[model samples]
Target: MTDWIASPLEWLQNYQLNLLFSAVVVVVYFIIRRIVLPKLEAYVERDNLNQQTFRSALFTFSLLSAVVALGILLLIWGINIRELLAVSTGIMALTGVALFATWSILSNVTAFFILLSHQSYRRGNYIRVIDVDNYIEGYISEINMFNTILITEDRETVVYPNNLLTARATIINPRDRKRPIGKIEDFRKTETSVDGGLNDKD
Candidate 1:
């Protein structure tokens, strides 16, 4: 029993550098989580990102950090970094192919970055998507990584793919208008004025 315990301890002592590297990785991870993450969160908050968008961005950042940390740990364990990178590249290539096979998934991810960079729309802002006889008008409730949630006038929630929004023309109304332009009453009034002017011309 003592030999079993001592054997593990000896192995650990033999790889003291690896042990120290592991400790350093742990410390760095904690620093990122505790300090870096909070700063990023604050920045997102300051920029007025919604809760869902902030959480998605944070999660993506954490995942990337974990992947980098794993690569460092592997390097410290005497693995050839070149070989590891080659393997990672192969895996990424395969993943890229898979994502390409599902075009919407890839497009949405691309559109997400585009949306992040452009502040044309935000939560609570009304937007009208111009489509062929399918004009969608709603207030943005949430903007997630893959989709933008819209709350319609009738209180119905609609999920629109990010890519679709990015690909199309969207009219954003920063302030909720008391009478939306699409209202029947407004259209009738315009039509009546046109008719009255036409009769006067006669």
Candidate 2:
């Protein structure tokens, strides 16, 4: 009976630190989601942005956080960092040469998260992007994981890169399509202009 009781106590003493750390990681994850998610929603809602996109962002963030937490737990239970890096590298190597050419695609994916947080653009919102080469005036039709689909005033469809859209100065028609010409607000700067650039009427 003493041996049985001592065995369990010894096991607990050995694993108690791991148990405490694991609990901490779980609690922190919950705290972050609880505090951060609502703030994200509030920011998106304040701008009248898409809740769907914000949810997508939240899902992505949550998934990454979960992965990190899992890694921490594994480490607490004794997984080597070098071993983890080797596994990660092996997985990357399996992707082969095509991975080398995915810089633009990866950048756009990263930019999508950044763009979704902006106040100036939304799905179905009429706006004009003042790109480096020229300007695109259109109604935002679809925003995907890679690109933003724009339907121009001339009935043309434009597949604009999320990276460029975030980088450039965009004009949003605040009154929406009904008043598509007056009071253009810049994407980078929140200032509104009435008597100036891009005379978009259609």
Candidate 3:
């Protein structure tokens, strides 16, 4: 038990320079987590970003930070990062070729980030996609990694690909201090009238 405790102390004394470098790395990681992450989270909250988008961004940032920290630790331990990166790149290239369908998925993911940055529309906002052949107007119900769901006036749900949405022109109706053109009561009344007409015919 004493040997184990003394061994670590002796190693630390012998490797003072390495220990100092490691301490610096740990301090930097904590500073980034404490200072940088909170600032990013504050910005996301200020923009009223969706939970999914915020989580994705946060996860990406954390993953990048972990990778950087691992690289620094590897260098501190005298590992050759260049050879490791080269091997990783080769493996990634092969994986990319095998998962060619991933390109489409990646495009949708990329568009999701673009949507967050653009902030043109959000869930619960009314929007109209300007398409001559396939026009769509509805309230955004959800924004996912690959699709945006909209609920129409007719109670129909439409799923639009994120990539397609990014390419199209969209008109957004923000929640300003103005009366809504159509209320939920109006839709309810219309539905009741339709049901009544069907009953009368029966």
Candidate 4:
């Protein structure tokens, strides 16, 4: 045991190269997180998505990034990649069989990520989800990890799955756009059309 304590400098000298490479890996991971996460958070805010879902997403992505960093470290330390793949394969086989029935849940979670990146879509947007058979129109209330909460014009609530929403063609800004009018035109326009069109009143 005395020899172990006596060779601290020798041990560091032997592994200094690996340690330096590991430090580089760690710094790169942190740099990626610092640059990417804030932009994601900004998109979340701009889209008015659920903050709770954002926190969940952050945790999930961080876990993924940690796993990737660990894999790189294992490679740098001369660990056999095959063993890592074997263990990963075994885990996947178990989870895949167990989760076969609930695979849609995974799809919904992934679709939430896709939906989260769309900066133009917002919680307050009046959107129409159109499919071959029919369509549903509503204002987006909240976008959670699994489903989107929509409030219809009739005040009825629709809980739509994220995957389905991503599959469908969504019409945003379906409402009419109006041109800005000056004071003179504003005074000239005494009434609006009952149909919500900008027609002059007789």
Candidate 5:
């Protein structure tokens, strides 16, 4: 037990620079946590996207950035900077590959919330999404991440990827379309309606 502690302690003493580097890393990480991340999150929240997408991307980026920062911290603390650099490069390469590998899954997840937010179609709304170059008409039963649950007239449930949902042409009932209209308050009550009702329509 003494040998274990002694070895690490001796290493720290010999490489005091490593310990100093670690301290600097900790300070930088907290700075980013306090400053950068919050600003990015605010920007993401204000943008017009599915809340989930904004939240997810912000979270993922924060996690990735923190991890990278930690690695840099490790190099500063005691690990060889050369080795850390190599490891970081390798990690970046792997990240690029992973993002591409999971493109469809990510895209589907993003589009799912987008579909729901836009009210492009809602539960019980009839929709047609072409699959395999064939149009499948069905009613949306449930919409979730990755897959959308659709039920046909025959009561068969078809699960389709949201990526496909965004890509393919979709038809929604015109009656189901609802757009937002902001309220305007009249400063003074000037005119009454033809039927003796309040004329709020400007």
Candidate 6:
């Protein structure tokens, strides 16, 4: 047991360097999480939580924790840089798996943010989008990071993926902000055709 300990004793003798590095890393981690993140959150968050800011903070914290852990592991195990690289590669692989698993959720969330940035529609704005074979027109009930909740003229709330709403044509009612003017041009065309037919008959 003593022999095993002494075998790498010469290379691992610098306890002071390891301790200093660890201390700095821990200090940085706390400062970012407790100080910086909260300040950022205060600015970004009004009534709704800022998912993008929160995710950014989470990623930063995760990266810092992983780096600190890796460094400490190297110092304790006396492993060289090559082993550290291998471990980091494995961590990246796991991250890739996580991203793939939650891709749809992430996509919808991202699309929601994009729509908000455009200032296209807000709650109570009437709008319509093509879904499957027909376009669903309704008033915007709530816009969140995941799905857009729409209340149709029939007084039904329908949920749609944010991506679909942002991608397709949505007609908003400029008159009555309470209800969406789903398929605006279609209604106008129909009315015009009917009026022309009546005029011809007269």
| Reference-based lDDT, each prediction | 0.74, 0.70, 0.70, 0.76, 0.63, 0.63
169-194 per-residue lDDT for model 5 (tens digits): 77675343221211222322333343
Error of 3 at 153 (Å): 3.3
Pairs in steric clash, model 3? none
Give candidate 1 regions above 4 Å deviation. Answer: 1-25, 39-60, 94-120, 129-135, 154-156, 166-170, 174-202
How well is each residue in 1-202 modelled by candidate 6, as lDDT tens digits? 9988886785467575776776776676677567755654443353243466456545654665677665665654457778777986797676556433334455555565555545456556677576443567777776665678888777887988776777676666644433333434666788999999999999
Candidate 6 to native Cα RMSD, angstroms:
7.8
| 88-168 per-residue lDDT for model 2 (tens digits) | 678556434322234456567667766666666666778777646356678887665568888876677888888777777
Off by over 4 Å in 4: 1-6, 87-103, 175-202
Question: Model 4, 22: alpha-carbon shift in Å?
Answer: 1.4
In model 2, pairs of residues that clash are none
TM-score of each: 0.55, 0.65, 0.55, 0.71, 0.41, 0.43
Clashing pairs in 6: 126-180
RMSD of candidate 1 to the truth, in angstroms, is: 7.5
Q: Point to the candidate with the largest lDDT.
A: 4
lDDT of 2 at 90: 81
Worst 10 residues of 1 by lDDT: 175-184
lDDT of 1 by residue, 82-117 (tens): 898899889778666643343547657656656665
Please report the TM-score between candidate 5 and the true structure.
0.41
**Model 3 agreement with the true structure over 33-102: per-residue lDDT tens digits:** 8886776565456556566767776786687678778767777876767886787688667645532333
